[model samples]
Structure formats: structure tokens, C-alpha cells
Target: MEPDEVDFAHTDAADRKRREKATELARFAWDRAISGAELLELPDDRLRKLARAAGANPPSTRETWTVVADLLDQKSAWAAANPDHPQASPAHADEKIMWVKRPIPPWT
Candidate 1:
């Protein structure tokens, strides 16, 4: 669909609201990623707020899973570019992953 036609997917006011909220949350996540915060650091309440902004109930497990997956992608990219940088959480040991950006698919 053309760029303008994308709005058609959420023609209803409620649907539009939900989309906007979700987009905001995603943007916030990206901002935090840029600032060197772990995606999991985002509290559930914040995610719920984003869901509310989208005019829907707070995100479900599936949505959270998607968020985490995207975060891992970011972390991987960061690691490749900055191998010398310290991990996000050395104490946790599990937080040693880097951040990476998802490549824009040519299809877009």
C-alpha cells in the first residue's frame, strides 16, 4: 500500500489511537536503546501506559515478546560496532549483550 494508504488500516478513531500509542512506546524503546539502556529495563507499567496510549489494554505476553526480540536485535548490532565497550550489566553477567539496529528490509 502507498504511504498514505497506511492510515486506512486504522481508519477508526480508536484504532488510530492504539496505533499512535504503540508507535510512541516503540519510539521510546528506541530512544532508550540509543542511550545504552537495556530494553528489559523498561518496566511493565511503562509498557502498559503505551498500550493505554494506543487505546487498548496493556500489552499482552506476545507484545512483550516482540519487544524483547527487537531489543536483542539492537543489542547485537551495538556489540558488533563497539566490541570494546563494556557490557550493559557486568554484574548480572546475563546483560553482556550489545545493541544493534534492525536493517531496513528492501521490501519497505
Candidate 2:
């Protein structure tokens, strides 16, 4: 009945779609990136450094997947909102991707 309420009602579906698409796309790219690498159980601080290069700013307390997932979420959300922009693969789509992390030391 109220204008603000009506507006919210209309946008609720779009919001859900955006979030779903964002999560889906982000996970797909992350999955691809780690598909072949050996799984290392490193501390959150060390792992976040790698995710940071990929463009996510997750806190130092999150797990590796959570860190990367946050990155993917951000990228996909951006892509979905700006559909005209390059949607190829946000993780691999940017110019800053030239960043390469140093190799992870072997587990002790």
C-alpha cells in the first residue's frame, strides 16, 4: 500500500536474482582456479594474501574458500549489475590479474 513498501516489493525479486547470480558465477571461477592445485591447509592470514590478489578483501579470519568466495561474489555482483560490461569471467577478466602469488611453502 505504501510507496516505499511497494518499491521494496518490486525490487525483492531482482535482489534475490542478483545475489544468486553473483554467488553462482563467483563459485564457478573460484572452482576453476583451484581445480588443479594441491590443497594446502594454510593459516587464514597466508591464504587471504592469495585471495587478495584475485580482488577480494575478506577478513584475515576466514577460510580459503570463504576468502575466494567473497572475491567471486563481488565480481559477479558487479557483472550482474553492469550487464553491458565484460562478463566473460570477472576473476580472469581484469587487467590487474597479472598479479601472481609466491608459491606456498611445503607443509611442515
lDDT of 2 at 70: 66
**Residue by residue across 8-101, what tens digits does model 2's lDDT show?**
4237785564455434434544444432122233445644554454355543333335434566555556656887864524354243233324
lDDT of each: 0.49, 0.46
TM-score, candidate number 2: 0.27
Candidate 2 residue pairs that clash: none
Highest TM-score against the true fold, candidate: 1
Structural similarity to truth (TM-score) of each candidate: 0.30, 0.27
- Cα lDDT tens digits, model 1, 19-107, are 45455554444434432244445456755654464356665554443544465466557767887776632333332223333446897
Global lDDT of model 1: 0.49
Cα deviation of 107, candidate 1, in Å? 46
Minimum summed lDDT over a 10-residue window in model 2 is located at: 33-42
Cα error, candidate 2, residue 58 (Å): 18
Q: How high is the lDDT of residue 73 in model 1?
A: 61
Error of 1 at 7 (Å): 14
